[model samples]
Target: MEFDPALFIDLFARTFTFWWVILPAIFLGLIVGAIPGFSAANTIIILLPMTLAMDPEVGLIFMVALYASSRMGAGIPAILVNIPGTAGAAATPLDGYPMTKQGRGQQALAISFVSSVFGGLLATIITLLAMPWLSQVAFYLHSVEMIVIMLFGISLIATIAARDTLKGLIAGFFGLMIGYIGADVVYETPRGTFGFLELYDKVPLIPALVGLFAVSEAFFVIEGESILSKRGKEAMQKAGWAATIEGVKIALSKWWHIIWTSMIGLVIGVVPGAGAAIAAFVAYQQSRAFSKTPELYGTGHVEGLIAPESANNGVTSGTLVPLLVIGIPGGATAAIMLVVLQYHGVTMGPDLFMESPELAYGPFAAMAVTYFIMIFTILPLARYMSRITVVSTIYMSPIIISFTLVGAFVPRQYMFDMYLALVFGVIGYVARKTGYHTAAILIGVILGPLLETYFLRALKMSEGDIMVIFSKDLANVLWVGLVISLCIPYAMQRWRAWKAAA
Candidate 1:
């Protein structure tokens, strides 16, 4: 497909004309993304309803830009405080936290920002160039193929489940069960609601997600009172552009890791159901595998810092691929965008590309633009953002609780959501304390509906043949991939244990 200069010009015009809407969304996204527990997906859900009256193109561009920017924004806290604002930033803490302890906080923050911007911009280019081809591929995916892809995504849970595989599986199974609480897609029969009117719609995505990620994170924050301590003013003062440039130089030295991880991110992001967390983890593992001293990976290695940060940011554009091309959400953030698109009466799918290339390409172009903007905007503000690390838990607890409650209740205005958030907060704390991953459970929640719906539909479609899923070549390949993904982590853990014993 040839580049359409007219379309590019039109998108550029729209973005320039709607700078007011775009800038505010970008700013809000950055702020929310920087805040621990306020994830990009949740922020999109919170703000999507408000964007209903705006032009579809404007709203799409604004939200997509915000989504891309938030991935970078979350890195600030992850580097400074060791508390990842989002699961995607989890790998940042591996290296970034150590850098903070070593008084390289400014350097760490700078590296994260610069690498993130580079990864994002490069991924945007990949997205723009690949969308036409990807759209063509997406058109050929049948239900069986989609089911296989989702299974491949769900298998990632085993790898991320970490040491407590059983506990992680339990958490994931519980999440899947929770996802089934609403009406059945095929028969419209209520499953787990026990006749509660609210249950009829199934658990709302915003409330459940708020409960799982945000509320759970809040509880964890309160439990760990270290968040209340103040950093020395000297450390705060060290945040500046000079430090960032040094970090960028360090990151540039490890350019190969950045390129490969970003490529991994693009591929994963293109697959529906795989999100930023998986991308970060895969990049971290791959970086470790390729390191000259793998032992240094979790010990503040610069490559460790660069790989996952770049990869996570790279996913920002990748997630948009399926969303714009096939109408299927590649991740939770994209799911929220799906709602926004539906609200605007613009159906997502091949038709979206065929009909409204402006709406499709405008957001893609804006994402590239936002990356450039963030480098300029966030570099100068690193010191201010890093200061958030010093805010004491005593002072932060109430504010966090307030936002958690408000964010939870804002979606449905229901008190039940508040309770749900509190309950999930406790759950998250327990999971974290026990080494079971909240990310795995959240993935379950995100993919559960799709898994159940497709699995059941495939069964029904096959007239109880039960072998239809495996009968497909794509399904077989995905199943094999799932087995490998699950086994690798277990194999690695066993090898580590054995080596330690030796």
Candidate 2:
């Protein structure tokens, strides 16, 4: 498990030689990620035959490259059109879409691309250096600790609710109620499915995400001629490459923010079942809590955009740690990776590291190389991509609804999901028109089931004692941190008021 400099160098060189494989995967990943409901996991599943035909090492490198770039690509639509291509990008539009509305779409894309690439790259390097110790993270975090972590993400509902507490909470809790539609974890009893078998497996996330964000936005945008306002269109028309350059400069200026938020993603990714959605929200919440200008968040603030984009990409690296070290998949993509690796006869866990150290560590090296190449490959496109905002909503709305409906249908191939997406779209439109935050609702849907599962597990372990959540040392420490984080914003607000009076 010790870091071998020579081995790493060789791995890096070998990975570079696969630029042919890596480049294509990166491009494909970007395309897939830009389209809602298409993710690295499903894409890889479609290409399973091709991957199985390749050398195990080459196939793995391709998957790693695609995973990293896709994480970056999901942010593109989120920044330009307020559509999150993946759940990981859910937090992105809080600030990114606002920037797009203000005609700063190019800068937003530039900032997103730069932060995502560097965040993922730094995280990969850390993964390589700390592989031995980092692998133990999953083992250390049990259901109790995971529940706390889920709460950290769930707390984002409060953050979103700050603008209009009652409506936000109503939306969040309604989403939670929707999330509880499937069978109960322990008894398999249905809660709110209305007896449809499709609801047995819980609400399909792709349809829900597309319904709430893209489809709803499509419905709203039709009322306007363009997605941008008069000033926004003028600003965009006047914008040049300078906007992209300014974005990169702004992102680089917040290097420290990128580093820490990415670390949050890395840690969260280490736990099995923790996905990019949770990481992005937790990072955003923490970032806002510690910021000097919390009021500026949700208003196209650079840090708000940076926090989620960077953190989600950082998750790409963390998701692999458990798969490689403990033979457990951390997320959906990792689960698909496990299938590929198993088919290739690559044994996971510490034994693989001991037997085939090169194979064990090679994916990380390839991931780092993928991220490095992405800066050059994807960065310049930000200028052109920003122009997407200028397209007339007349054409854009139909295109969006069409693609999102297809996206909703692709994941489960259920015609019912397409209809369900329309249902959620109407719900989203109502929420938007009523001043409720869609993100809060989505958060509750995404994290509520996870919270319930972990909470149940912890209670079962403690013989149904509710106090078991505060029993473990690490859990207790995390609870204290959560309290401090929640209090920081209010404390800072009071400090500002006192300073103004003095």
Candidate 3:
């Protein structure tokens, strides 16, 4: 399909016309995203209803732009507080938190901002060039193929489950069971309602996510005496643009690392359900694998900050590709986006490009604009935001809990959601204290339903002949790919142990 210059220009104009909403959305999203526990997906889900009344295209632009920019925004708190604002930014804390302790917080924030812009822009370019072809490929996928794809996507649990295979699997199974609580898709039979009216619709994802990540995080953040108070205001004020420039120099010197990880992000982003957290983690791991001073990785290494930040942002754009072309969400943020698109009455898939290229391309242009704006907006404000780490826990505690509750309830305006949030908050706290990863559990929560729904559908359609899934060339290939993804981590873990023993 040929690019329509006139349509592209018109779409760009429309996107720019909504700069007022776009700008504030990005800015506020950054603040919310930077607050540990308030994830981008949760933020978007909470805010989605407000946008319901707006123009579809404008709403899409605002949310998508906010989603992309917030990935960078979340890094601020991750670096300063050793707490990730969003799951995607979790890897950022590995090196970012250490850097803050070393008085290099400004440098880490700067590198994260610059690398994120670079990765986001590069991914957008790839999205622009690849969307047409990808749309064509997505069009050929039948229901069975989609099911297989979802199963392969769910297998990412194995990579995530690496911390403790049994625990991970158990958490994932629980997530699947939770997802099954609502009415059955085919028979309308309630699976786990237990006579509760709310159970008829299953547990709402936004409230659960907000509770698990944000509200729980608030409790944890306040339980400890303030770490922020440790840094003097004068010392905290040292974070500035000078550090950012220094970070830029380091990133430029290691340009290859950025390019390689950005590519990794792009590839992972294109795969549905892979998400930014995985992209960031894998990139960080790969960067460490290739670094000359691998020992320096988790200890304030500049590349450690750059790789995951870039890769996660890169995945942001890649996540859009499948959504725009195939109507399939590539990540949690993208899944929320799918709702926004459907709410707007815009049907996705191959015909979307043919029928409403404007809607398809509007987000691409907005993402490019988001990248450009984020760099300028973040650099000047990084130091100021970093000082948030200095705020007293007493002052922050009530506010955090207030917003956490508000964020949880805003999505559905239901009081029951507040209780659900509280429950998940407790769950999150317990899990953290036990060394069980909240991220792994959240990943399961995000992907479990899709996996179970599709896998079961595929099996039933094939008359319980599970071999039909393997009978297809594409399914077989994905199955082998899943095996490789699982095995590599195990192999690496063993290698690391052996090297240490030697």
lDDT per residue as tens, model 1, 367-429: 877777677777767655556656666776666667756766765677876777677677777
* Per-model TM values vs. the true structure: 0.79, 0.95, 0.77
Off by over 4 Å in 3: 3-22, 31-64, 74-104, 136-180, 193-195, 221-224, 228-238, 264-308, 319-360, 484-502
lDDT, candidate 1, at 412: 69
Candidate that scores best on lDDT? 2
Q: Report how far residue 113 has shifted in candidate 3, in Å.
A: 1.9
RMSD of each: 4.4, 2.0, 4.7
Rank list by TM-score: 2, 1, 3
User: Model 2, range 5-94, lDDT digits (tens) per residue?
Assistant: 999988899889999999999999999998999998889999999998988999999999988888888999998999999989989999
How would the candidate models be sorted by lDDT, starting from the highest? 2, 1, 3
Q: Which ten residues in a row have the lowest lDDT in candidate 3?
A: 153-162
Deviation from truth (RMSD, Å), model 1: 4.4
| Alpha carbon lDDT at 114, candidate 3 | 81
Task: Please name the candidate that would achieve the greatest TM-score relative to the true structure.
Answer: 2
Q: What ranges in model 1 sit over 4 Å off?
A: 4-21, 34-60, 74-106, 139-157, 164-166, 194-196, 205-225, 228-243, 271-308, 322-360, 490-502
lDDT of 3 by residue, 1-502 (tens): 4677788777767677777877888887787777644566777877777878778878888888888878878777678766566667767876887777666677777778888888888777777767766445444555566555544433454344225655655665566666667776667777777777776776776566666666666777776555433453444567566767887788777777778888788877777766777678778867875788866876778888888888988888888888877778877778888887788788887787778787778788898888877777777776666666666667766776677677667656788878877888888788767656555566556555566566678777888887767767776776787677667767978999999999
